[model samples]
Target chain A: MRVLSSNLRLFWQGTLLSYRALFHWLRPAQYVASKVFMPLAQMFFFVFLGTFATSASNAGFYIIGNAIQITAVSGIFGVTMSVGGERETGTLPYLFGTPANRLVTFFGRAFMHILDGMLGVVIAFAWGVILLGLDLSHTDLPALALTIAVTTVSTCGLGLLMGCLSLITVNVMFVNSFVYFLLLIFSGANVPIAELPNWMQAISYALPLTRGIAAARLLVGGAPLADVAPLLWTELGVGLIYGLIGYVLFSWFEFIAKRRGILEVF
Target chain B: MNVRVLFKYWRTILIVAEMTIRQQLMDGFIIFTVLFQPIIIALLALWMLKGKGPDYAIFVVVGSGLTGLWSSLLFISGNSINAERWSGTLEPLVAIPTPFEVIIFGKNLANVIQSLLSMVLGYIVAAFFFGYDLTIVQPWYFAVSLALSVFAFISFGLIIAPVFVMNPGVRAWQNAMEFPVYLLCGFLFPIALLPGWTTPISYLLPPYWAAVSLHGATTVGTAPNEIFFAWGMMVLFSLIDLLVASRLFKLMLYKARADATLGME
Candidate 1:
């Protein structure tokens, strides 16, 4: 009980501190512009293009997919920056010297981002319904919400893996932006997965948001929660695998840093 | 900001442009901004608009190319002065005998010129990968339109660089500003698809005129009068932007020198 209580406290503090440190510098207006307006604008652009390509009736497909994909704003960039920022800001040394549990610290970095990412998706969905005339009358709202949460967490899982790469590279932003945009294509946000070539479809399934997006689409199409269970489960599992790999990488990096005395050398 | 001054320092401008292009090529972020991002956008667009048939290939190529141009202008050229400040060269550069705006013009020239490669890359991708036989219907007209669009974009950038330097709040809104312009400027699709209220806003943007001219130049059936009108609008905007940028540059330099905030963010 005592160990659990202490770990919980550490997790909470680290989660809040890292998130604040990363974004609190931006004024509220700037935050709203970046966090709120930017994703909405992006959603509008794709939704318009999608409708133009086919017809106005197809707007819902893009509205949902992009709204869900917006979580990656928090997942990929936000979470990656939280972890990578330690190295960039020269705090890695102090972090390493501390005797806290590495698991708590590592996973804690993504906790606030998961919640933040969920809110972003929710906002995107709200804008979709309000501005773009997305009809959700038939959707199982709870299932769709579940899909959003699952998708955000899964995307953040990939973010964790990308964050570990930041420890060794100076071009973390480049990597993060590249992966984020690739997800825009590979995850079936803009282009339909079925329309893609066989090899591209294979890559889609390997990605985190693929199942989550498909699941969300089905739920919005009025499918019951049970119908998307397998997809949600697969999405969660894929995220777990990525997160575990990230953990392994994080541990390996820590070990190497200590032995070689290069905790923040790069 | 007088157009004549640019000609006076032509040699210096070219040297600065060459150096800026060389330095920026080595940066991964710049490379992604100017080249890879547009290519990826083109790929996604070609796939998304696949149902629109082959006529839309040149549209995607040109649209995605404008995306690269706008992105390069917003980020790289918009930060030209700030980039100098960051590298601790702003003061020395200002102290030099050459006019400050002249050097920045050269840098913008490099950024805009390098960004054109995004269109070339998009053309290749559309031609070879997507197997679309891309052609410019009026090659000379398209060439002239492209040159005017580059100058207009450079002039527009001159205003943004100083404004962002003077106002960090405005700079913070940079990411949010990107896609709206792409949408408003009718980069990939017609702005008529947008609401009626946005038409006036579209006309207010220089890139909208660029799109009209470029897209008009690509189709064999478009009226030459429409293309010429777009060129007129671009030239008008360029003049207005240059005048506005001149005032902004003067005010920015004064504040930076007076407040001793040149080295500060």
Candidate 2:
């Protein structure tokens, strides 16, 4: 209980520090413009394109898909960029030298981003319904919420992987953009997985968001939680795998950085 | 300007373009965008149009490729000055004897030259991977339309580059401008699918003119008059953008020197 309490304290502290750093770096207005308004416009663009390509009934597919994909924006971009920012600001070495559990510290900073990403999805979905009149009356709200939770954790695991990779990689942003576009295409965010080639479809199944997006579509179509359990389980398994791999990679890189004493180099 | 000064200016622009190309090549962000973005966008579009026949596949390939060009111009060329500012070169560049606009013009040219790879990559993907027909309606006309499209987009980049240099907030504005322009300019789809009210706005943007001209030349049975109309509109928009950009450049220079805000952002 004491250990759990301490971890919880670290988590809240990391979340507050992340928010404070964010506000300090960007003005409130700029943050809102980039984080809020920009995502809304992105959603509007895809929703309209989906409508043109398919029909109004398919808008929910895009609405939910894009909403969830927003997690990538926050999860992947946010996590990697946070590490990049630390490196740029010359605090990375100090961060590594600290005695605290690295995973707890990193996860604490990254934790709120999952919520931020979910907020993006919620905002996009709400905007879709209000502006585009997306029909959500048939959706299973509980199932939808579960899908969101799984999607956030799964994508955030990938984000953690990206953050860990940033320590050793020279061009983490490039990797982030590559993963971002890959997800956009392969995660059934824009195109249906069925539309992809067999190999591509197989690749999608291995990706973090593909199963979660499938579950999301089912929930949006009013499917029961029991119906989406398999997908949810698959997504959870993928998330766990990514999380474990990320933690291992992060620890290995941290050890290497300390041995080489080049952690300060950008 | 005198003939000697004109020669000197042209030489400076070439030197800047040469250096900018080398610098951009070493930039991971620029290279990633240039190489990966177009292919992914084109592939995604192709997947969406899987059963829409080979002709539509050709349209999507070309459209997605050109959309990549536009995005590169906006994010890379448009933010070139901002990048220079962050690197502490903007102040020295401004202090140079040559007009800064000349340097930016060189940068824009280099960017467009680099972006042409997207077109080639798109064609290669379509022809080899997707197995779409590689024929054009009027090869010479298409070639001319393509050249004009690059020129028109270069002019568009010039206009935004100044706005980006002058206002830090314009970075957010540029980010905000991206997808909307992609939709409005009919980069991947026909603008007719959009509401009627947006038509005039699309007419005013250079990308729309480029798309129409390129698409007109690519698609068979497009009336001869329609092709020429696209070419004419492209030139008109290019001229207008150049004029507007010149004014903005002057204003930006004046403010930058006066306030010493060239490196502010």
Candidate 3:
């Protein structure tokens, strides 16, 4: 009970710190530009293209897809770059030296970005709902919210995994871009997974957003939670696997860096 | 004296542009931007436009290609100053004898050239992979518009470079600006589809004019006068953007020198 309470406190405190840092450290223009307008613009770009390609209904498909896919960008790039950013700013050594449990510290620091990713999705969805006149009356709001939350968590896990990779990889830019565009392609954000070749489809299944996006489309069509339950379960398991593997990799790398005294080398 | 000085400055800008292009080519990230991202966008468009006629496919192909060009300009040319700062070279680069604007414009030149490669790659993908027949009724007009559009885009980059240099935090805005510009510019579709209010905004931006001229030159039944008007607008916007960029660059240099924050961040 005490341990759980301490972890909870850490989570809240970490979130508060990130929230403060986001606004205080970042200029208002930048925050609004990146966090707000960028996702909306991305959604608009694809939705319009989809609209041109087929019809308004297809545009709605892309609207929901791209809107939810914002989590992949915000959660992944934010966490990964923040990791590289800490190193560049010469603060990683101090961070790793702290006595707190690494896993808790990791999740704690990333908690708000997870929320921020969800915020991006919400904003995009709202834009779609308003601009595209997507009738959400048929949508199960609770189910959609739950699916979004899980998707955020799942993508955040992959982001954390990439963050761990950033610790050892000096080419964070390439890694981040590769991961980002890879997800953008494979996750059916802009194209249907069914259109992809068989091997690519297999690869897509292992990724975070495939099931989430699938479930999202269904949810948007007013499918019940029970129908989408299987997909949500698969997504949850993927997130857990990534989180666990990332934690292990981070611990191993941290141990090696500390032993070699090269924590700040890169 | 004025002509001689201007020639020397032009030489310096060219040198900087050459160096920037070489350096950027060596960057792994550029490969993704140049090759991977554009191809993915084209493929996505192809998939989306599969059942649609070849005309839509060609439009999206060119659109995605131009998206790559615009993205490179936004990230590369726009961030060239920020990149220098991060590398601790901004101060020394600024302290050099050449006017700072010359160096940035040179960098923008290199980025513009690099972005053109996307168009070529986009053409190849559209023609070979997708087997779409591209017909340009006026190749010479298209060539002129393409050349003018490059200058217009470089000028556009110049307008934003100062913002990145002045406030390092605004570097974050680069990503934000990209899609918005792409949407507003209507790189994939006609700007007519955008609501009544946005038309003026699209008209003001250079990319919109570029897109209009490019599309007009390629499509059949386009009026020669319309294409010329687009060319004229691009040139006008480029001139206005350069004027604005000149003033902003001067202010940025003055502030950075005064604050001793040229490369601190």
Candidate 4:
């Protein structure tokens, strides 16, 4: 019991410290500006020009698509880049030197990333509602929140895995670019998956973003939470599997790098 | 004095450009990702339109061609700037007597040549695989539109380069711009497929005009004088972006230099 209590305390402290570090790394002004401006700019551009391709009834659909996009951009890109940065800056070594459990440390940092992703989503949702004049009543709020949470956690897990595998800054950039293209192509971010080819649909179904977006659409189209239960369970299961795999792989890599004395190559 | 300096350094710039091109090509992964990926995407679109008329194939060809050009330009310029900045070489290069404009101009020139080559390769592959009949009735108008769009895109790239220099975390912003442009710019489908409000915003982007002009040139069988209008708009946008980017680059230089000096202490 005492050991468990101590571990919990350490985890809490690590999470707080991670947030502080991230806050320092990302200046407040820049964070606020990115959170506010990016979504607003996208809303304006999409709402203004998207009408030429589709219609107002589908504006709601576009808003939901943009939401998934915002999550991917903020969670996958933002969280993974910070992890890679920490590895590059030699902080991970000092972090590992501490007596904290590695899993706790990993989850703690991931918790902070989830928080950041949630904040970005809230800001984007607000921008979509207020600036773009999107109708939120069309969406089930609880399911939307649930979808965001699951998607963010799953994406952060993949990001953690990629960050562990990356050797250089260019590697991170390449991975991010590749993932962006893959997600956009497969996730039905711009068009319905039903409209896509069978092979593409298969790929989309395999991605967390696709499930999350599907659940989100159900919520946005005014379906009850019970209707989205399958989606929620699928996302939760996939997220846990990916998160566990990532945690194990990262721990193994850290062990190897430390044993080889090449941990500080960055 | 100017002529002498130009003559002295011009050969060095050409050599540097050549080396940059060689290094980029040697990276087979990058070549495949940047060049072949677009062709694959074009083929996918072609597959979707397997039973459509030649007009639809022509539309896909033009859209894919423009998309290929935009993506090539964006990835090369953004990634090159990012690589230089992250490698800590940009500061040293900027600290030298060479004007920053010249260095940036040289980089843009290299990127343009690389992107043009990639576009040509992509077009040929797309044509052979997809059975696209690319007719060039108003070659001059098409050329003019493409040149202007490339210029505007380079300027847009410069405007965003300072962000990579300042905060590497914001590189996603550079990419986030591409998604909307690709979907909304009437690239794979007509702009009319989008909602009513999206058309004007698409018009604002240079790629939309390039695609529109190219589509008209290839399909309408007669060159509309509107191609000149698109070129004029692109030039104006290019000039504005250039001015803004120049100012931002200067600011980035001063700030980065100060940060470096402080760290040295």
Residue A165 alpha-carbon offset, candidate 3, angstroms = 1.4
CAPRI rating of model 2: medium
In candidate 3 the C-alpha lDDT for residue B204 amounts to: 82
Which 10 successive residues of model 4 chain A have the least lDDT summed? A44-53
DockQ of each: 0.80, 0.54, 0.63, 0.18
lDDT of 2 by residue, A216-248 (tens): 888777788999999999998897788778889
Docking class of 3: medium
Residue A62 accuracy (lDDT) in model 3 = 90
Distance from true location, Cα of A46 in model 1, Å? 0.5
Model 2 Cα lDDT, one tens digit per residue, B35-85: 678888888777666656677666776687687788789889899788788
TM match of model 2 to true structure:
0.94
Chain A TM-score, each candidate? 0.98, 0.92, 0.93, 0.87
Considering TM-score, where higher is better, how would the candidates rank from best to worst?
Answer: 1, 2, 3, 4
Top candidate by DockQ: 1
Whole-model lDDT, model 1? 0.93
lDDT of each: 0.93, 0.79, 0.81, 0.65
- Top candidate on TM-score is 1
Candidate scoring better on DockQ of 1 and 3: 1
Candidate 2 lDDT: 0.79
